[model samples]
Target: MVQHCAGLPLAIVVLGGILATKNNSLNEWRKISDNVKSYLKKSKNQRPDDVLASSIASSKQKERDGGEIAEDVAESYLMELVESSNIRSLLFFNEFFPEEALEKSLPLEVLNYVKEHEDEVCNPLVCIFMISRAGTSCLKARGIWRYMFNNFKLLRALNYEITRGDHSVGFKLPSDIGNLIHLRFLSLKDLKFSWIKLPSSLGNLRCLQTLDLRVGNYEIHVLNVIWRMEQLRHLYLPFMCKSRTKLMLGTLRKLLTLVNFNTKNYYLKDLINMTNLRELGINFPFNFENFNEKELGENPFIIRSKYLHSLSIITQWLILSIDPRHLAHLLSSCTSICKLSINYARISKLPEYHYFSSHLAYIRLLGCEFKEDPIRTLEKLPNLRILEFESSFEGKEMFCSAQGFPKLESLILGAYYNLEEWKMDEGAMPSL
Candidate 1:
């Protein structure tokens, strides 16, 4: 009996279940052993689980007046079990696994597999979470998402993380996706140099709160219909050249976080009414030579909301410059900003503002060459907790005075090739 079950735990458990339900007659035991052996002989190349499944199916058929079950009918039943088990596994697994790990592996496989067996899989249309990775997964097949969207009307979130290595096989979003009014969160990341075609129908997702599209090197086309998504709370998109169309975004009063957006054709005034905004990320386009810094600083478009706490600016080109005076205006505009990140901009001197916001706690500077010592200007921030410098500042010496950065906890300085000297006074960065 042990040899017939091959000593596998799952097989033993299933056989035990079968034995528990049947009469303990020698004839019944012999019949079950023979059936298992016959199925094992037929499924030699398949997994042991497959053989067990076949044996169970044959036993059930024999019990039902010895009628044969159609292959399609049998497959449908097995698939139903698999679908239910997989969904439960995902829901349980998500509690322990990190979001990035879940995003890259299991969830993506489940979506594609369910989509492939759409007709046979039970409840295939209900997707609570879906993820598609690059190259390795079958979801990369062109228009697969579009076809799948027709089935997934109740989808809540969809994430796509494609590698930039294979630009030729980029995915597309069908206009039909807009029909999924229940969708609340969506993300499209890492489509380098690939063009993403957005449909005007995307604006129909009024229930959407999070839209993340921070592809490393790609251009996303937007339609004016985007401004109509009144329920948006977080918006993340790529920065491209100026669009001819205008977008009035201030009406999205519920918005809390905005990231990596282009402000080329749209005036800063369009965002002044977004009173609930807390975090802002801007990736300035390359054609900012014509943008007037003085005019922008004085413009009523300045963000004065107390809810605004984080600000980030990204620049790709070398010619794009941010003046010290303009920097001061930005700092003054958002007095409550706690976190600030400036990247790839040319700022020769630190802003003249002697005292930064009292609430400011974190500062990250990258690729912004400085002619003056930034450490001197930054050390006085009373509530500063985290300071990071990457390939920024070329000063010869840095001194940390006593009582500097009283609440600071973390200090990270990297890629400063020319920094030769550092001095720290007693009690400097006491909490660091």
Candidate 2:
């Protein structure tokens, strides 16, 4: 199923959602597959862009002969991908093209979408994407989104990236954005701005499933409206944002991938509700403020999901603020993690073997500088396959017990200049 969409996440969602409503008959599915192949394989020699370029040319010719003007066409094919009911998923692809070439035609096509479709008896739900091409002229992109917000109320996916050069110094999300009740995906990632704040009206996007708020070159303040998106699956906050940008997410019970989360803005208890979460990332300065190490052992903060396979805690060379026991109990809570990565944690010692996840297959530690030998402790992990250490030890002697690392396949040690003695028992690391 993943391979069929070329492993593109948006394509997977769009195709999967479309397929869910189809009949289970194999013959019927095979016929639909043939049409998909024909649509994608327009010609043996034509690349995807070539097919797109040809599509614009064909749409323009059709428009001249009295067909729909914005038949998912741009004045130049590279300018914009117009929305078509059948090919709604292709417009949001991250493609880079010059904005100067299609300056005149971009607005005309966008403004005409509502005029042509407003009177249609029963139009299918559609999606529209407005990718901000670098070097876009300021005058060429004005009033485009205003038109979209005023119209296109049935839009499902809207990926809009605006450049600092394209808009005025102050930019605000239009209140009408809340009217997009049917929207499933909304990505404003890579918007170059100074300071932008999400409006309270954004909570009206009750049906949104994917929301990306990553911004470039400036800070964005997200309001607490995300808690209203009860249907959200994948949520990405800004890579960097205002310090006190209080946002709540406890209601996202069905969330899958959560990125750029720091302990600063959100509460740890909120994680208890995301039972379906699979991937989670903690951004810089993962603060563990007001922690009690002794109490942590008695009552660990267990993340409820057993499906979480990857865990990452990345910081900017800052030492971990919590004690080693805090990390230990935290690791013990995640019993299903297969891979673990921590950088500059300053824990001084690795967690006890019993505290580590038994399912862990790979581990990487950087700059932790464990005061004690980690080999003896970590070697007991029954399913361990790979172990990596970089500047994580400051010892002159190291030892591996007999019959240790039974299933290990790869071992890497780096930047241990103080090592003067090394001992491995005869039967240790036999599988290395």
Candidate 3:
């Protein structure tokens, strides 16, 4: 039944999933094949939705026979679908939240909704929680969040970010948040508040798969319960933590995108466990468990993740602590990375061309204060196409040799205040 609609993505996914489950077990594969054949013989007009439903029902029957572990395996199938680049980005318009009711149900649809309906029962089906930027939203959001936690048990997605437009009181995350057991996605980013008190009950969200906790404030007390979210795939941590934030993440084999990872919150050696990671963002002033700041600045450990494709680095402005050697050693491990962003780093020149990834295509340098010609090594990046510099380099003149940037297409330079001349030879950037 699943394979009848052979060319369609729906059918392909259904068939591909069954193959993964069977995994070299011909007996299991034959059993599933027989089950699919039985379903197809009953349906006359083969439709995608009908075939899809039959496959799901068949999967459920197997889960019932195989016990509770099968249920976990079913969830893993869902994660596989989410991880697939082909299906992940496809937009399912209002699949959860109704388009017509969204205007009336969204908590912050109107700027005055929170103020007007402090005790209002928001539409229970509301999935996306985007509160207005109004500062007053923070005060009233407490009751709203609590209500949702207690009521919306099966809610799948939630996003909350209430800026402190004029309010001074901090937002307190309700401990009852653990009650949201079915929540798969949650984002609390850009809450422009003074402080955030994270509840320990947050560990109860075992089903959460995607979590973003990057608030604007620097003071965020993140409990070490994140290791419990074994299903987490994309995790965006805060830019900085309030106190010591230690987490054991060796079990998160499914994690793919990790942002704002620093040694203070995580063990640097634990990175090797996330072999499936594709995108990573880290903070600077490399302070690992055993390495002192001075030691790390002198000789940094070379990261080794073969699958990482994107890397974002943000160096703290604390006494200009980062060195070019530190970044050189770090980039050597991420040879597969395609996009690189270096922000507020202390390096005065670009790293050697050999340290850059072989797949590097785009680079954005901000506040690096490069005095030498930043293009010397960068222009040699064979795959580089887009290069952007924002107040990143300072010099009286810059040079680009002939045939240096063969694949370059876009070159952007901003805030080059002291630049006196830009010298590029013929064929320096043939693609531009």
Alpha carbon deviation, residue 300, candidate 3 (Å): 10
lDDT of 2 by residue, 184-225 (tens): 999877665433777678899999999998866566777778
Residue pairs whose backbone atoms clash in candidate 3: none
Cand. 2 Cα-lDDT = 0.68
**CA lDDT, every model vs. true structure:** 0.67, 0.68, 0.71
Q: Which regions of candidate 1 fall more than 4 Å away from where they truly are?
A: 1-143, 163-168, 191-195, 239-242, 286-301, 316-319, 353-355, 423-427
C-alpha displacement of 94 in model 2, angstroms? 10
| Candidate 3 lDDT for residue 290 | 59
Can you give the lDDT of residue 48 in candidate 2? 76
**Candidate 1 Cα RMSD after full superposition onto the native fold (Å):** 20.4
Give the number of colliding residue pairs in candidate 3.
0
- Weakest 10 consecutive residues of candidate 1 by summed lDDT: 127-136
Of the two candidates 1 and 3, the one with more favorable lDDT, higher being better, is 3
TM-score of each candidate structure, all chains considered together: 0.63, 0.65, 0.68
Question: What TM-score quantifies how close candidate 3 is to the native fold?
Answer: 0.68
Ranking by lDDT: 3, 2, 1
